[model samples]
Every structure is written in structure tokens, then in C-alpha cells.
Target: MSSINAQRLTVLAGPSGVGKGSVKALIQQHYPWVWLSVSATTRSPRPGETDGVDYHFVSHERFEEMIAAGEFLEWASFSGNLYGTPRGPVERQLEAGLPALLEIDLQGARQVRVSMPEAQLVFLAPPSWEELVRRLTGRGTEDAATIERRLSAAREELTAEPEFDHTIVNVSVEQAATELVELLGSPVKAAH
Candidate 1:
């Protein structure tokens, strides 16, 4: 495989319950210096999620205002809530020569492909369709209706895996993180 530019901005995308968050967290644990952009969302905070950290929770009107002002690099509505990556923070990270990571949906990933053609897109895929269904249902957070919707969306997202520069099957968080870190060509602190 070709070496990746360490400073190149990367967008990591996958369907819900495909372990994107787990892989990202593992990467951060191994490479603390790497910067991951926190997205802004109009959705309410989940159980232990924090504002300004996990996500920048915003009101629907505020989100729309930001959209009008061209504040987001990409924005999309999912599961009845709006989610977007703030343009300023990501630009700052890239401008500072940092390896920036954006964990977003397929819609946002497509937007990044248009806005930043050089941005590397990585797709995290489940080992199998059955595994995906198991993971989604095992989450225990969503209802049957939501799970069904997510499964439908997952099927669509799976079709877009070929659109990414790389596809990593998330069988193990450590292995996936190592592969992702290698793809970024960045130094790691230590695996957690």
C-alpha cells in the first residue's frame, strides 16, 4: 500500500453500530496527539455524552442558522436530528499541520469528498451483515423501529463502501486502530 500523508485530513465513515466510535476511541488512545473533530448536533445529549466534547449540542434553529452562515464543512439529518462538522475547528487543525480525523456519516463523507478532494476517506465495515444486525440490536439503546431504520440505512451505507479509499473490517478495535494509524502514517504513543 502507498504511504499516507500524516497531515492529510481523513474522514472515517460507517453505518450506525459498525463500531466507528470504538475504533476512533482506540486510535485516540494509541495516538493522543492525533486530533478528532467533534461534530455539532441538534440531537439531545445521550446518557453520558458531554457538550463540546462528544458533540456540540445545538438547538434546531441555531443549527439552521449555522447552515445559512456556511459554518459546517458538511451537514446531514439522521434519525430526525441534524449533525454537522464545524468548519472552523477542522480548518484550524489542518492549518496547524495536525492529522485531523472526522468520524461522520456517509452523507457527510460525500460532502467532504467534494469539498476536499484530497481528503482520505476510510470506511469501517462490519465483518458481515449478520454481525451488523447483531451489533445494532445488541446496543439496547434504540427501539425496534429505530433499529429497523438503522438497518435499512446500513444496507445503503454498505453499498457506498467502494466510494472510500480504504475499507477496514472492524473485527477487533485494536487491529482496526492499528491499520488506521498505519494508514495515517503517524506515530503512536501506545496502545491502550
Candidate 2:
């Protein structure tokens, strides 16, 4: 395939606590070649999140400016916070013949589908709904009401699994990372 045709802009989407971050981290550690696109968000950073690493952490006005400039490949407002994938970095990586990964939410995934139908959408699923609830509650970052809201969103996300081109159940981090790397059309190296 031509470099343009083999851009491999893969979208990894899942519910709030389905280990998408964990799997992506593992892949980055083992296969540094895969470029994971950082999203721009209007939300304030959580306890350990750093700007540019976890997200771009832009102001709402700045995000709006970017939107007006057509800078985002996909963007959506969720629970009052706006999140989006910047188009530049992903385009650069693809132009360099590198596989680009976007770890985004369901709404962003749908937007990407609309904009780039050739992009691969992968749904990372929890082993079970009970396990999903357990993981979300175990996070301890949110209040009871917030956890309930996340669970509700998760239920809706789970129902949209059929919308994805592929589904990987996150039973083990190593296994899921391997599956994700394979889906990106890259050979998995030795796991650290």
C-alpha cells in the first residue's frame, strides 16, 4: 500500500475504565515507533496529569479558535468539557509512514468515522460489565454521583461496540497491547 493508503490512523475507544490508557502506555513503551496522538481538552488536569502528556489542556476559547481554524480531525463536547484530536500531528506521522493511534472517546470516534471512513476504529472492551463497574469504582478519583454518571456513559459506550471495526477485550494488559499493536499492522517486539 502507498504511504497515504497505509496511514493506519487507528482509533482506540472504550468506556471510562476499560484500560485503554494502560494498553496504549504498554504499546508506547515496547514499540516507540507508534505515534499516539495527544488530544486537546478544555477540562482541568486531574491529580497526576500533565499538560501535553495527558492532554493539551487548552482554554475553552483557545479550543474554539482551533475548531474555527479546522485544526481538529475530530472533536466533541462531553460533560461540559471539549476534547479533540489535533489534525497536524496525526497528519505528520502518517505522512512519515508511521502508524498513528488516537485514544479517544466514543463521540470522537464517531466523528473520526465521519471525517475519515478509512480509519480503523477499535473498541477496547472490559471482560465483563461487573468488572467494568469494579474498575470505575476502584479509581477513587470521582464522587459517588460522578461514578454513576461514568457508568451510565459506559453502558452507552458498550452498546456501540458494533460500530467499531475491531474489538479487543482487555483481559490482560500484555494481551490487549499485543492485540492493539497487531491491529495497527506492526510487529510486536519483546514486552518489557
Give the residue spans of candidate 1 off by over 4 A.
Answer: 187-192
| Candidate 2 RMSD to the correct structure | 3.1
Candidate lDDT scores, in order, read 0.89, 0.89
Q: How would you encode candidate 1's per-residue C-alpha lDDT over 40-72 as one tens digit per residue?
A: 999999999999989999999999999999998
Misplaced by over 4 Å in model 2 are 1-6, 46-48, 187-192
What TM-score does structure 1 among the candidates reach?
0.91
Give TM per candidate: 0.91, 0.89
True lDDT of residue 43, candidate 1: 93
**Cα deviation in Å at residue 27, candidate 2?**
1.5
Please give the range of 10 consecutive residues that has the lowest summed lDDT in model 1: 183-192
